[model samples]
Target chain A: MSTKTDKIDRLAELTAQQESSSGASLWREALKRLRASKMALVGAWIIAVFLLLAIIGPWVAPYAPGQQWRGEVFVNRAEFVGARAENWFGLDHLGRDIFSRMLVGARQTLLLGVVSTLIGLSVGALIGSFSGACATLGGRVGQRIDSVVMRCIDIMLALPSLLLAVSVAAVLGQSMTTVMIAIGVVQIPVFARLLRGAMLVQGGSDYVLAAHSLGIRKRRIVLTQIMPNSLSPVIVQATLSLATAIIEAAALSFLGLGNPDSAKNPEWGVMLTQAQNYADSAPMMAVYPALAIIITALGFTLLGEAMREALDPKLRG
Target chain B: MSLLELDDVKVHFPVKKGLIFDRTVGHVYAVDGVSLSVEEGQTYGLVGESGCGKTTLGRSVLRLVDITDGSVNFDGTDLAKLPAEEMRTFRRRLQMVFQDPLGSLNPRQNIESILSEGMAAHGIGGTREERREKIRDILAKVGLPANALARYPHEFSGGQRQRIGIARALVLEPDVIICDEPVSALDVSIQAQVINLLEELQESLGLTYLVIAHDLAVVRHISDVIGVMYLGSLVEEAPSDALYAEPRHPYTKALMSAVPVPDPEVEDRRERILLTGDLPSPANPPAGCRFHTRCPWAQDTLCATERPALKDVGGGHKVACHFAAEIAAGTVERTAASVVPATREEMADRVVETPAE
Candidate 1:
């Protein structure tokens, strides 16, 4: 027979190892894994810098964004004022300071991105949770309710998202609020479908049945157990949607369905639109705003992808 | 009266068609007409093959699934007829232990919260300290370390996770615990420990159990009374010793024949009853006696046309079969026609049709 000390030592080591990890939850463990990923750290840093710029861009801008003091010097047909010391980033076709417009535009872009995402996330989560709860716990009548809600969602999903966004913006009339609503409305079906699917899976698990048998109130089960467990995918979708929302908002502005008062508070998309007239003379004006938009969208996309990996059940062990 | 009496329980799920506007095409009678009772502090084991509705029956006890037509009389009141709100309160005395240990406990919750949740819902303890004391007491009874209360379900081994599930049930001081395939998910070595823990808990706490499992040996060991399910109904039920000593039903005999005797001599001497054909779909179950299609001693007319009642054949042994007496007496021989391949028409009819509801 083998000696027992070595086995005992191994067992003790295992025990100590287990003892060291007290109350480490799925979320906490995911957070730890997220911290370890360099991708997540880089993405987080980009978002942090972007948020800082959004908050402080207006105050730091050298000139008033709406002022077109160098109008006479910036004749689009004959002469172009390239980036110079006096007017860094040069004057636009309308002779507004290009650098100052971009800086102030940062705050408006951030507002559109966050507000649209929030609109989509909240409305979608509410609709999804309602539909899921009905389907899972509502018995026969609940099934009917789910079918109705899902059919409506299906109709929304059937339309091409960009076309749908365009229609919503066209109907709402041109403004920042219009673009936000349009993007938010387009994201509704996606968020709703994801949350419902996740909740359906969670609702069928043994814990849900266990909770039911425990005589926990059905409302409490739906709210506390089912809702919390089903939120991860929705959350991942929200982050990814943020990037999409920003891009879509810019597209709306470029299409002239965004803020009407472009000269006063110039958005990047509006700048790109205004720059189209001076394509031969001032190509740099379009290039600057395009780069800004692409980089910001990239930041959110990276963060979203990193979060998806961290939260993945396959990677948990 | 028995502590829990399930009288003529049935659960039928409707088959629906159409995307938005649904139509009830037919019904899948999942748990069709099953009735059994359990005594206080007695372990009533239910053994069945897969897809035999044993799990559904267990769920029906707590009304987790809708009871089509039945009277689930628990401690004098019919739970089937109780208001949903009242039933929620009444669930304090009844609990369920699930097959999957990890799946049963919330992955995000600590053992303390998992155990205390039921107690909090039932209003068992007045204060947090009182609940924690009770929870700790139960954790010990289930053979878990005190430190385990702070850990999540994923941290524990299969057996330990099972204990946490049991602890969650026990915290509410439930009188009856329906263990649905409790030990099946565990490892062989771990299965015995969990089984022993269940027995120990029963003896110490005077807890009654309605255990649903497929393992014959596990059932015979712990169950005072054992019921065997085929399709959605009980085919045989008797005292554990009596059922093992002499299995009366043809289906029971076939099930028992599968269990190999440890001694080589005895094992070789025993006759093996190998059943032919797969289990018919519950949606279109055989017309009458559910087991008639594959029963070794199946006759043409009576076995196919008429459903058999669970009749007592002396010594508290109940069986649902027309030829139980003749077969037990060694008079009726095995029919070769029972094993015959299905005819072309029969094969065509096997595809279940959606009947108008």
Candidate 2:
């Protein structure tokens, strides 16, 4: 008994030695790869700066987002003509500080992007998993269900995304909620197709077969064994979709389909529409909001691409 | 009563054709009419070449694949007739260890969850603590340390992973285990270690196993009863010692001759019967004796027109052939019907000739 205990003790020591040497899990391995890449770091920093700006941009602004200051400053046309030290981004057609509105617009654009992307992701993932699960668990019935679900997705995918969003927003009436819903609805087919493809590949893997042989419930096997392995590509696609969502939402608002009270609230898309009249006189008003959208979208795209490279098992050692 | 009985079981996968609307044109007879049994504490080894449907036969008993016909009796219950829920209940008594050890385990799950999955599924342990204790005990029994429970499958070596696979099957205290080439993927030394561990475990736990492999030496070493499968059908079934000493069926004789002997003197004098062609498409097997297409001693008349049933010549040994006694007594001579082995180009032409459609 003493020798047996001692043998186990020795084996335990060897096991601990091996564990400490190879402690990284899949997520940790992906993180290590992400940290090693220079472009991914730049992307991370850009996203962080934008997120911080969105959260506190209103508090740090020199003036209110919609404060009109025509007569208060230069009493005449000079307020609209040149830049002032007080207003770093100069004045718009309404003589409002472009810098303040730009800051607040960051918040509005980001809120739209995050909310719509979440809706798209959750709804798309649910639909994809349902179709994927049916195809995996139902056997003959699953093949029929798969064809039906995929055909619906194909029909949605056939329509131009912006056109679909436009029609949906037109039907729902102009509001922030409608813009979010429109963008999210447009995004559904993309996520659904991607996740369904991933799930199909994972469903045929040997581990899923092993799980089935163990007499695990089909539902449990689909959820626990197949779902987790199928998530990496879906997650990477979600980030990329955020960039698309932001652009789609902004396009809807630019077409006079955003919140009706945009002149008071001052979102980036509404701000762009308001800046169109003074494109020559005060080009800074148009440039600032456009730059914000472009930079924010680029940040998400870069990060998503970097994540795809990092999480790819083939790319790893 | 036998611990498990497979009575004339058959599993045929439909071969569908056409791009738009797939219609079944033919069936791949993967496991065609196989009947065998495993006693309570005996090990049954099934030996066959690759694609001969040995794995399909093993999986049919566990109901991993739906049987097209016949019954699988497990502990006096017909598993083929059992409802899905009732069959799930019986899964605790029958488990499988897969061919690819690493591929068989979920990469995301820790060892504790993998080992305790069957237990938790069947409500074996009362609480988390009890389950953890059970996992720890099984790990130790499989020659793993206690710390293994916290690690994932990737952290272990191939041999270690196979041990974990066995531990998972053993954790449920199963009555029968269908091990599908459990050690074929490991190093030779590792294979020996795993086989010895299986033997020790069987002695301690009194477990019955249905071990499937392509290696005759490996099967002979571990099996109490051995069955040789040729193209989705059993050719011979006998006690392991008897089967190794005197393999009666021509297919079994060809299989036994192919196993390499370690001693050079004995190896040089041994007769080797090279088969004439690859396995004919299972979707369209020959009309009569399936082995007649390639058998060296195949007669011209009855062997091609009539299918022979497995018959007991004496004792419990069974053989499926037209002239098992003549071949065993060395009275029959090899016929000149054996064709030269087909080349790859010829094989490809054959495949194109009979498309599934």
Candidate 3:
């Protein structure tokens, strides 16, 4: 039998050796595997481009978005290149620059997507984690609360998300913050359910049990052990949820629920609304904003898929 | 005082109907009236077939599975009565190593993070360096290479992961560890490696263990005292040598006989005791003695009608049988022995009759 002193000394020596080695071992190998995923690299580039567009898009446009460029003839051709000077991508019924409007529209769409998702994730994560932690303490109370909350989520999920957002926007009045909150509210259920399910799975795992055995606090275990483990699935869900939020925001805005009376506002959905009347004369007006929405949504979806694959070992190659 | 004591602990879960409108009809009694104790620096082995509540008993001691009734006193504190905040403080002294090494450790965390997580949660160290130092020391003690700190769980072999799981438990300098079928999930050769590691760690650290497993060979190697569980109750318990040499409980005798001897020569000559049938469902266990349906020496009228208390026959050995002395004295041979084709067959019949009840 080895003495505790000897075990302690041996442990000290081993730890000292690990500290001296630096990042010369397995850290380098993990970096190599991350670099090898081609799709991830491509996804990274796409995200970078969208981020760049969102940052500098407004400054580079020739004309202010939503400002009418009078006397500019509308271009009718669907196959036009990036060569037009007056009303670039041709004139909408309002004679606004479609290219300029699309650029500014990118900023609003991206902001709405990111802000709403963050709000959803934070609110939903808190509710879900609290529900899980409460399940451990007030067993029956937690279950009843969980059922009520989940059923409410189920009701929201049953309705077409666009319809839910429109009604919420209609109730709260037409504004960007209202649209963001409406979209965020619609997304809460998805995050709440995802986090709750992940928590249930983590709550049963031995590591969590081990944490409990060590006399770790219920809050600490839920936050540190349960949250970290559950976050991966939540993250994956949040990524996909962002795309849906962006779509919902656009739908609400298109239905005239956006910032009304801001004639200078070039929100993507508002831009689509203005362009719909002149679809034949300037098809690019609708096409450019529609394409922007699809591509940005696509970016989040791909990133979400990659993250889900990376985090889930069962799904990993 | 005993370091840990459980008096008639039970863990039951309501079996909800799968259908939307199905009512909660009954409870799955995962553990029923299990009572046992472990002294400081001693290894107590809990042996039983799967679903016999061996794992459930271990989990309840940790309060991982909530106790439906009774009390668990750890170092003189009633664990079930402790507040949530106080319970967290109590958890650092007791740890658990699970059955599946892969399933137990978080897949997202690397070795260092996983090892250091317990220390961080319990606030064991004052600074980051102190925690890092503690993790480093534990990795080596478990025979893991120090450089393995940066690697994820997937990068390691099954044996290495089990070692990591052990390191996570030991890093906290815990007083008691409940190993729930720790080695049963590993390969045969790897099981020896893990068993040796656990024994070596125990000797060095004076760690007390509540080792739950079905593998008797592994149990015999590290256990000072062994408790045999059937359904959800401890049917027999005694020191390792005493229990193996002259098992008083018929269930234990059948279990000991079932352990395959390595040598073919001895294997051919030695008499084996086989039990019949699978474990009964814990949701609706049989009336009277839980093991009555499968007890080889079961007196149908007496065994089926009376639930025997765990009585001390002598020498700190306890057996819960109406006829324990008769069985222990060799006055009663298992009736199944004559009817069964082979000793192994009789042992199989005995184990199956209880069916996890």
DockQ of each: 0.59, 0.43, 0.31
Model 3 RMSD vs true structure? 7.2
- Per residue, candidate 3 scores C-alpha lDDT tens digits across A144-194 of 777667777788888887787788888999788888888887787778878
What's the TM-score of every candidate structure? 0.91, 0.89, 0.84
User: Which prediction has the highest lDDT against the true structure?
Assistant: 1
Over B282-330, each residue of candidate 1 has an lDDT whose tens digit, in order, gives 8889988999989989988699999999999998999999999998888
CA deviation > 4 Å runs, candidate 2 = A1-24, A68-86, A90-95, A270-286, B17-22, B336-357
Better by DockQ, candidate 3 or 1: 1
Better of 2 and 3 by DockQ: 2
Roughly what TM-score does model 1 have, to 2 decimal places? 0.91
lDDT by residue (A189-304, candidate 2, tens digit) is 88888888888998888778777777788888887888988899889988888888877776887788887877557787777776776676567778877888788888888889
Q: Which stretch of 10 consecutive residues in model 2 chain B shows the poorest summed lDDT?
A: B336-345
Clashing pairs in 2: none
What fraction of the native alpha-carbon contacts across the interface, defined at 8 angstroms, is recovered by model 2? 0.38
How many backbone clashes does every candidate have?
A: 0, 0, 29
lDDT of 2 by residue, B193-236 (tens): 99999999999999999999998888999999999898889989
Candidate 3 achieves a global lDDT of 0.79
Model 1 accuracy (lDDT, Cα): 0.87
